[model samples]
Target chain A: MAERTPTQTPATVASPDPAAPPPRRRRRMKDLRKQPGFDTMAWFCLFCLYAPIAVLVVFSFNDNRSVVRWTEFSLRWYRAAFENDGIRHATWISLQVAFVAMVFATTFATMAALATTRVRAFKGQTLTYAVINQPLMVPEIVTAVSTLAFFVLIKQVTGLNGIGFLMLAHTVFCIPFAYMPIRARLEDMNLTLEQAAADLYGTPFQVFRTVTLPLMAPGIVAGAMLAFVVSLDDVIITLLVGGPGETTLPVYIFGQIRRGITPEINAVSTVLLGLSALLVSIFFLIGNKRK
Target chain B: MATQTEIRDPGTPQAAAAQDVMIHAEGVIKTFGEGAGKITALDNVTVDIRKNEFFTLLGPSGCGKTTLLRLIAGFELPDRGQILLDGQEIGHLPPYKRPVNTVFQSYALFPHMSVARNIGFGLEMQGRPKAEIKTATEEMLALVQMEHLANRQTDQLSGGQQQRVALARALAPRPKVLLLDEPLSALDLKLRKEMQIELKRLQGETGITFVFVTHDQEEALTMSDRIAVMQAGCILQVGTPKEIYNNPARRFVADFIGDINILEGELQQDGGAVLLPGGASIGALLPEGAARSGKVSIAIRPENMGLTAPDAADASLTGEVTNIVYFGAGHNVHVALDGGGEVLVRRAQTDAQVGAKVGLAVPDAVQVLVD
Candidate 1:
């Protein structure tokens, strides 16, 4: 029919091939070979992103104290950072905080995403979403100050003191980060699958469990990673709200930086940077797999 | 010319109630927007969909055809009517609670799930035993001939392949009714034609009531056991494909269904002959007790417009062949009438040419659209 129609019909040629794979491959090949100004601009943008990470990797192996200057290569800081008890304890605290915060963040983000996208009408939806995103919108200092004030007020009423409040505060900040990714994932998801599931004898709740939740996993995983990063790196919120013996890694690193220049601090920073890099690499490896 | 009209549904009112009517919708009304200015999507539409039948809601895009499909699927709530599934009022029930499924136009297979998982999802939700889900999923996958790709992710499959997976997924549970909303509309023309046959085959194999919604005339005609042609928000007519195409009850139905050569004529000769608007006389074998008088229209299929060179006086509107299009299957010739209006003649491409002056016989091509 195509052979016949192409000979006779004057309609525009939109080949019925839905597999656009070959064209995409050919386009990439053509662009690489041509190397236009647009290619230079794109490469320059990539260099802008990658150069700092390169510098950070180089500095991790440097013997010098400064971030830029390099001396003889050494693994001394990495070894020392691994050995320091304060750094180890702080790392453990950050891990605990991130782990706990992830649980809260994933749950809240999922519920919030569902409520935002599903259900016909809900009272104060925009307000609820804005409140969920408060940690991201308001200044970190403001959040810290508010967390302190809220904790003090709680203590004044009925004392519930500990870094537990600090964890909760960090969870609040991680929500928007988590919610951002989950919501974006939800936006990409097609609603027809849920409808199809329902039509195929699944109850609304069953459809969510079998269809919607499974489809949203990738997004939930992304949100969890973002939440973990936020929780681990949080300084202002933990600094103001964390109680005794609950100093987070960033707080510990802050104190060290203020004190004096030392290989121990560099060692600790290197370890922290390594963990983040590991997490980021895993995130991309899992998340960026194409169909 | 008082010939009898042998309608399948006898004119007696009792015939409407006595049948194996699987679905009964009573006076369904749906209105969008609110208050006095509300737009009526379905205006008191009442239809009975029979069991194991291929039924189509055929109409233009916004003619409440999809709204009716949704109403049947429990996705939509009619404003002031109840629908009964197996004689139980289930219109108010949500889509999940209803014993029906839909094959969406988008073929919405879960992108994250493997084809087997996608098809087995409904069984999993019902807490079916693992072995049962596994066996049933395999059978369904085999039914759609997608068993080979069971472990493959849905997003990786082609559009037609994904559509088959969606079909397997929907048909896995074996619902009482299968509502398809323009299911083949998203596919390429060749694939759409292929899926049409596959859908029909599957419908026969499963023996479930299929409520298909489509704006394509040929798709509706080729697939449905009965088609309900709708306009605006009202059903213009409902009949078998042959009935709708061969004997259209309205002018719009004639125009919408397929290529029809329409000739405007004044009702004359006490309903014997029609004096065409272009002053050409033509004869019609009118249906008994049909149109009355004055202004009327005559419609005939393009193939029914026969050519007799240019030597006739009392024939279908005599026209000169302006252009001929070779559509592979047949030659569609465009003809300009000597009076005013034009005529389209479709003939076998075996022996036809362009710019050939021809006289069309109007004896069979004339029908009293209005009288």
Candidate 2:
């Protein structure tokens, strides 16, 4: 008893002190804690994500080239941003790329999503699924390298410096991104509405045109917006494949940053930020309205 | 099977029933799949639903009654036979093209549309005038007593209300025949009974041939002018509710139609009497050559018999009382008869008490159906 007294006492004191109260408290608090929880880990992750972006937005308005210390507020850099021909040209190119890429991506995404979900079983199902999901599974660097190799091979064989290749590559990368949402929407849609339409004497084509397409509009729009945003902000795939005349906004932003940290870039960043946020908010509003 | 349908049903409109072949099926066979794996859902089935009659397909689940309804509705094509509606071969007609509308088991109300839109859906699709659709939709909704709630969403309404809307929608089309698939099963008990009466009334007021399907025996007895009891994808018996309940042709039909005691026995047929395996004889008289002296079974309804003390001189059988149940209208007594047989006897509340010793006296003519 005397020899074991000290060790037993220390074990009881330390073990209970560390975990017993916590275990009991954790068990008791579950009901209350579960009701209004936002998942602390998730909230913390989002805080980590947006806090730096907030700092970037705040610093973009910083008055001086060296933004660490706030000097004075000024619009000089913002004015300079508007006048920069390279930024303007890059912005126009980004808009054009985004428009072209999204149109191609959304159309192909809708067709692909419908085809995948409609055909019950086929020999190429596995192969087709794998090919479509390849961009998600493979490393971005591997895709960039392979795409560059493929583009160079195409040019060597055809003797055409095709600018459309970059847009196609960006579109290819965005298909799965666009397709995930549309396919999920299509798969989750109830088939009874369409059946009711058919029973009411509407032909299959009429049912699809009137009922199915309208119900799926939100998904299509959301997917197209996602593709547009992805194409606008693309850097790795664009850098690997884009020609000298077709520099997108992100690449232009990158080249500017490499040369120097200027206030003009900050103004351009602010405009791009506003545009993307507006697009996402609009996407969410329309998406939730239908479902 | 010989058709025992009364050629001149008092309820049938004269003009409609005058058309001999109002709706008939000739060996209609509908198989689900192909080859060896196929399920013969309907097998050489034939029945005629005389116009303006509430003809019910009565059966347990998987009995192919609803399949028969779907075939008539043109929702399904028979594998090897033809179905004629109003003496026309509608064998290949689609549901929309055929002048028949189905009230599906689930009601199949479009979740996205309102009650008014759903009721007017068929009219709208037919490209009818907007005013006509609105008037007809309102009139049909009013007929079902659901006009006040026409603007409410389909998903927002109660099950019974939704069923009413479905009825309204199907009725608005004014098809030649209205096909209902267990429509009342989706409602509560009270609502189901109420809707059954309402449905019969609707059939009367509309004067449309309602070919309905139901598994509930009491419901079929109450509503159907004629019923077809199906088992294992074939029609076993078709008769009026009274005929099916009282004069069921086979032991199975009698047992299934209502609560009846199936007494399997040996027959000792004499000139006017028939003795049983349990040595109890029934029927004071039988027509000559009615049955041979051999094995037979009789279906005895619980309500047709009474009990006397077990020691009485004219006792049907000596027995001890086992249990007594209080049915609201009567008391049902379970007695262990002599020689280890159990019999259920129903009586008015004043007729018998629990544990009372009694002999049974089944009526001389309680419709003794032998098989």
> Could you say which candidate leads in DockQ?
1
Report the Cα interface RMSD of each model, rounded to 1 decimal: 6.5, 18.9
What ranges in model 2 sit over 4 Å off? A1-43, A73-78, A115-134, A141-164, A285-291, B1-23, B26-40, B71-80, B250-257, B267-274, B283-294, B309-318, B351-353, B363-371
Lowest summed lDDT window (length 10), candidate 2 chain B: B1-10
C-alpha displacement of B81 in model 1, angstroms?
Answer: 2.3
Candidate 1 residue spans exceeding 4 A from truth: A1-83, A120-131, B1-14, B32-40, B129-135, B146-151, B268-291, B308-339, B346-360, B364-366
Against the true structure, what is each candidate's TM-score? 0.83, 0.81
Expressed as tens digits, the lDDT of each residue in B1-371 for candidate 2 is 32322223347564444375568887888888668888888888877788889999998888899889888876678887888899899877876677787787888887667899899987887789999999999899889988677787776666677788888888887878888999988666777888899999999999999999999999999999888888767776677888787666565577778788766555454424456544667673222223655555667788876787676656666677889888799888998877677888888864555667678776664343433
Q: What fraction of native interface contacts does model 1 preserve?
A: 0.66
**Share of native interface contacts recovered by each model:** 0.66, 0.26
lDDT of 2 at B23: 80
Q: Among all windows of ten consecutive residues in candidate 2 chain A, which has the lowest summed lDDT?
A: A1-10
